[model samples]
Target: MDGRASFRRIAAVLGVSEQTVAHRYRKLRESGAVRVVGRLDPCYLGHAEEWVLRLRCAPSATLAVAKALAQRSDTYRIQLASGGTEISCHMQTSDQRARDTLLLDKLPATRQVTSIEAHQVLRLFRGGPDGWHTPIASLSPEQVTELTPPPPDPVPLDLDDGDRLLLGELAHDGRTHHAALAASTGWHESTVRRRITHLRASGALYFGVDFDEHLLGYSSHTLLWISVNPAALDAAGAALARSPQIAHAAATTGPTNLMATALCSSADALYEFITTQIGSMPGIQTVQTAPVLRIVKRAALL
Candidate 1:
C-alpha cells in the first residue's frame, strides 16, 4: 500500500510464496521489459550534440518520410505530432559534424521534405531503462504495478545453470523456439520450457513486439517538456496518461518538469490532444514541443 516495497509485504498481499515473488521480481529486472540501466552523460560520452528534427511533409507522404528515416540506424523514434509536420526523433551524436551529416545533410535528401530544422540540446537530463537516465524529452513514467496484498501465489521453479543459459538466449530473441534455444544455449527442450516459465513467472522475462510508429501511419511525433505545478502533477499526470496518443510520459528536473512523446494520426489531432486533453489541466504552466528528427540510439537497443 505505502511505498515500503518489502518482499514479505508484497508477497503476502499478492497471494504467492515469498520465494516465488522474489524470483519473479528478479526476472522482471533481467528481462529488458523492465530494466535498471543508467543514462550516460552526453558530454562525457562524447555525445555533446542533441538535435531535434522537424519536418513538413507533402500530402499523403507520411510513410515515405518515415521509411527514409528508418533506413538509418540513428533513427531512434518517429511519431506524428502536431500540424503537417512530424516529430521524427530526438537524437544525440558525438559532435556537430555527425549531427549535421545525419540531421541536416541527410534530411534535405528526402524528396518529400517541405522543411527541416535540427535544434541542439543545451543542457539535458534523461534516463533510460534506468529512470531519468534515458532522455528528459523521452521520459515516460513506468506503470505503477500494485500487487494485491494477500497470500502470494505458489509456483514451482527449478532453474539450473544450463536452464539459465536457455533463458539468456530467449531473452535476446523471444521468438526463438525451445528447440533452437536448446541448441544455442546447450539445454534440452523440456528444460528450456520449464526455465522459461520460471523466468516469466518470476518476472525475470518478457516478450513483445517493438512498434515502429512510422510503419503504422503515425507520421508526426515530438517530445514536449512542460512545467506543471507540483501539487497539480497528480491530476495532470492522470489526465495525460488517459490519452491514447501519448506514447510515453515521465517527470524531469529543471524548467521543463514533464516530458512526453506521442504519435498522432495528424498534426491537428496531436494539437487537439495536447491543447485540449493535457493542456486543459490547471497546473500546466508552459509547454515546449521539440520535434525529433532522428534517434541515434535507444535504451531498448540490446
Candidate 2:
C-alpha cells in the first residue's frame, strides 16, 4: 500500500504539494476512517513465529481475560467471545528459536493459558469486498458520524447502481479521476461529480485511510482472545475502542469473548502496552496472547 509513503514522497509521486498531502491526511485521521499503517515482513522484523492460543473459561469471564492479555506489550491484539468453549489469540515473534525459548516456553507460563496452536502462513490474500460501490439505500447514524464535512441536515440519499459503483471507485482510490470514472460508468463527468457531491453531503462516501505498520518497524503483532465477566463487557469494550494502537476490537460469537488487534514498535513496547495500558482497565479478568504469525489480510475499509 502506498499508504506508508511519506507526505513529500507522495507529493512527488502524485505531482502535488506537501501541503495538500498533509491536509488530506489530517481529514482522514480525525474521521476515524483513515489508517495508512505500515506493512512489515515478519521474517525481517524478528517476529518470525506465529501462534494461536485457545482458552477455556467461564462464559462471563472472556472480556476480563481478553483485556488482561491486551495490556501486555507483546500482545498485538485481542478478541472477545459472546459464548464459546475456547477463546483464541493469534501471536507472532521473530523466529522459531526464540518462539520456543521465550513465547512457547515463557509466555504461557505467565498467564492461565489453556491450549495453543501454531501455523506458518505460506501467503496472504487481502481482499476488498465488492460492496464499496454497492450502494446502500440508507446510512445509519453511526456511519454518518464517520463522515466529514458533515451533512447539513444528516440526510441519507437514494442511490442507484451507478451511484454505488461511483462511490466504490472513490472509496477504493480517492485519487481516481472523475473523467475516467465517468467513462467507465457511462455517465458524463459532470454527472459523476454531482453524484459524488450528493453522496458526500449525505455521509455515504468514505475516502480516508491510513496503513503504515510494517514500514514503521513494528516488530511484533498479537491478537488476544479474552473471556471477561459478562456484565462488564459493554463498558470494557467501549474503553478498549478508544486506544490508538488498538486497531480493532469486537465481541464475537466464538469462544474468545473479547478480541483486540494491536500494533507496536517492539517486543518490549508491546509488553508495556499489555501490562499497563490494557491490564489496568477496570473489570478485566483473564488475558491470553497469540501473535499474528502471518497476516492473511489486516486492513479494513476506507
Candidate 3:
C-alpha cells in the first residue's frame, strides 16, 4: 500500500494475475488487517511544535484519560504504558500556545491525572505505526518505477480552508474518490485532484497503511527509551531506523534523548531483538523498555 498501486499494475509487477492481486487486497481489507490513510508532515503544515507526553494517573482513570485524549484531533498516537498506570501519547499543534493548552492546561484540569512529563520532539528520524519499513521486499526496482505516479508540484505553505477540508477527507480515507472530496469541499473534482497532487509532491503529505499487527505475525509492541553518547546519537538513530522491526524512532529533548517503538511476533522474539539488534548497537548507554498494552489511537483514525 505504500504506493497504493492498482491491482493490474501490481499484478503486472509481481507476475501474478490481476484477479489474484484483487482477491488478496479484498481479503486484507475485509479482515481489517489493513487500511490506507493519508498523513500530514506537521512541520511543513505549520504544526512544527511536537511533543511526547507520559502521564502517570490513577489506575482507575487510565482508560478514561487515554480515551479522552484519543478523541482529540491534535493527538496522534496514544498507548497504555507497561505499568498500566501510565499513558504515553504523541501530539502536534501549530502554535506553542495551543500546544500548551493541549498538553498543559487541559490535562492538569483532569483530577484523574496525577503527573505529566512532556518531551519536545527535536528531530524525527522515523514516525510510526505508519512510516516504518517492512521486512518483505515485494516489488522489484524496475516494477516499482513503472507503478510510481508522476510527482506533483510543490504546494504553498499556507493552506486555505478548502485545502484543510481536503486533507481531513484524505485522513479519513486516503483512497477517497476525487468526486467525494469535491462534494465535501464544494470544489470541482479537477480542483480536488490538483490540490491533492500538489500537497503530495510538496512533501507535506504521506500515506500509511494501518492495521492490526497480529495479522502480519507481530504480536508484541514495545517502546524503547535509550540514551546514547552525544557523539553516537546519529549512529544509534540510524541503526534503529534501518531495522524493519522499528516502527518509530526520534531524537527528543529530555534525559533519554532517543525514543523508538518496535514490534515482534512474541515476547521471546522481542527479547531477541532487544538483545541482538538494539543492544549490540554502539553508543548505547541506558535502555528502558515499555510494552504497549493497548493502542488507544493510531494516525488520525480512532
Name the candidate that leads on TM-score: 3
Lowest summed lDDT across 10 adjacent residues in model 2 is found at 126-135
Compose the digit string of candidate 2's lDDT tens values, residues 31-111. Answer: 644553212223222335444455555555555665555544333323443244345555555555655764467546645
Ranking of predictions according to lDDT: 3, 1, 2
Backbone collisions counted per model: 44, 75, 0
Candidate 3 vs. true structure, TM-score: 0.88
Per-residue CA lDDT of model 3 for 122-205, tens digit only, reads 877877323775564665677657765665344557788988888888888887878999999999999988977777788687
TM-score of 1: 0.47
Pairs clashing within candidate 3 = none
**Alpha-carbon runs more than 4 Å astray in model 1:** 1-168, 298-302
Between the candidate structures 1 and 2, which one is better when assessed by lDDT?
1
TM-score of 2: 0.50
- C-alpha local distance difference test of each model: 0.55, 0.53, 0.81
